[model samples]
Target: MSAHSVPAPLPCPAAIRLHCAGPLEAVVVAALQRACFPEDPWDDASVATLTAPPTGFAVIALDGQEQPVGFAMARVTAEDAEILAIGVLPQARRGGIGRCLVEAVAAGSHGRGATALFLEVAEDNQEAWTLYKVCGFFSVGRRPGYYRRRDGRVAALVLRRNLDGA
Candidate 1:
């Protein structure tokens, strides 16, 4: 992929608008994050700090009504970028919002001179794992017992996607 391109196979749905969230929008993004991942919520202040500027940035997905529905936070360092967090509301799942957020982050990271984008997903999260795979990400590593589940713990699959045509 080039810096100006989003993954060709995954396009943003017409009804959804993707906005690059500034620091001022951290609170709203935090709320959406909480709604999407009630089990692991980041406070507004933390969200703000994580997505401040320069190496850090966020992309928010809005519905046609202009309501925040999903978000992706990422940071670029050297030639690599990592997705700090990403989620879409339960009501908005399976509608291509998550894929849009991933592509947005990937494009943003590429713009910032990143060669690869990385993220970790719980091994048991088939939905997200499948999405990443479809987005052209491949598992490069794994961390055992990385996620605390209600039943026990699950491993985290560390996935990566090349962004600079590397």
Candidate 2:
């Protein structure tokens, strides 16, 4: 792949396995989170919380070589769920990995009895906004200056979607 090439954005959910993330994956998940969210990242403990079995759920996407490429984490409580974090390496994006990670989270959460999913995204992050919208999320509210950046604060757009269809 060239430095400037963005692979065709095609849904290849079948080719990837959404493995349940566990304690063993914490090290990798933490690194991916930090690389993807330099401004605000989660630690190893936070990533390991997903393996607690009752409240949180996480999935790691691995390529054909069994290398981690992306992940999604969420919290589920009965009929409600909230996304905590998600990321795909810069080189692996535009290949629908992010979207698949989200779908995996939704499907897994729904299987665990969650019907609605909630999340917040920085308003200025158009890439994430577009991804959420495409995944069936809609803006339900906004928190002004909710995210702090080195330069300034950014608003957080609260997004929600029904996972019943996923």
Candidate 3:
């Protein structure tokens, strides 16, 4: 498959598996960050620290080869769960990887007793906004200058999803 083209579905029933990330998955997680966000990418150390446990949860979705195609990370507090970051590799885009990752993260958060989930997205990223909406997120607010774009513009949008029904 081309670098930017989504591959055909794997012969094995495509399953999005979630796991409690650890040091071993740092490299793949870092790669996913880089592919998803060209403006900024998480380093291996950051990935390891975030996945360390207690404070956060890092989950990954793998292809048939066990390659990390997407991932989602979130931090849970007493009252709410904040989705820290989520992205799918460029080659895996539009193949339901992002949705799978979000579902996994939401499930994990709900299991931990979190009632609501929140996240911020770049204002211009309509694709992400659409996905979040489909996943039951609603625009609650916006943060001025939340993200700096490559063209030197700053924009932001706040979205929240209620996990009560999930």
Candidate 4:
């Protein structure tokens, strides 16, 4: 089997739900991180920090089986919110999970009075860049060598969206 063929593509039902992350959700979140980004999976401490109040937000997307297949994490202040991380298990990609996660975060941030949201994507991550653009984010700047790769090279692109108008 191929590396991405572990989880079969499950039909996304209309009943899918998004919920706030809690301590009990850590394991699922870790699983998602491992599946989506094993090279830089979040540690327990980091997940704990992201689920804490005031400084951060984390949302999980649960399928009909009540299994988590997607997630998004963000950090927010009075005026701005930053998408700290987001991912969907390989089988879950291209099925609207990522969009749902982004929308969930955007709604939460808007409710908290954030006027804008920002995120940094790897320069080579064209798929993610396209997704963010479709979600109303636009290139605001670039940070050369912002992301360190396993092979020692670095590249990054900064993107932002105005929550009020977008």
The model with the greatest lDDT is 1
lDDT tens string, model 3, 16-107?
Answer: 44455765778777888888887888898888877666767777777777677787888888759988889988877897878767777777
> What's the residue-level lDDT of 24 in candidate 2?
71
Task: Show pairs that collide, candidate 4.
Answer: none
Put down candidate 4 lDDT per residue, 1-166, tens digits, no spaces.
Answer: 3321112133334646777775456677767777888887778776877767877877888787978888878878998999988998888788777877887788788777899999999989989999998888998998888876888756778889998874
Q: Per-residue lDDT tens digits of candidate 2, residues 1-166?
A: 3332222234554555556776777888898889888878888997887656788867777787778788778889879999888999887888888888777777777778999999999999999999999989999999999999889999999999997775
Per-residue lDDT tens digits of candidate 1, residues 72-104? 999999899999999999989999999899988
Indicate whether candidate 3 or candidate 4 has the larger lDDT. Answer: 4
CA lDDT of each prediction against the hidden true structure: 0.88, 0.81, 0.77, 0.78
lDDT winner, 1 or 2: 1
Candidates in descending lDDT order: 1, 2, 4, 3
Q: After superposition, how far is residue 135 of candidate 3 from its true place, in Å?
A: 0.2
Candidate 4 regions exceeding 4 Å error are: 1-15
The TM-score between candidate 1 and the true structure equals 0.93
**lDDT minimum window of 10 residues, candidate 3:** 4-13
Per-prediction TM-score, please? 0.93, 0.87, 0.85, 0.86
The clash tally of candidate 2 reads 0
Count of residue pairs whose backbone atoms collide, per candidate: 0, 0, 0, 0
Pairs of residues at least 3 apart in sequence or in different chains that clash in candidate 2? none
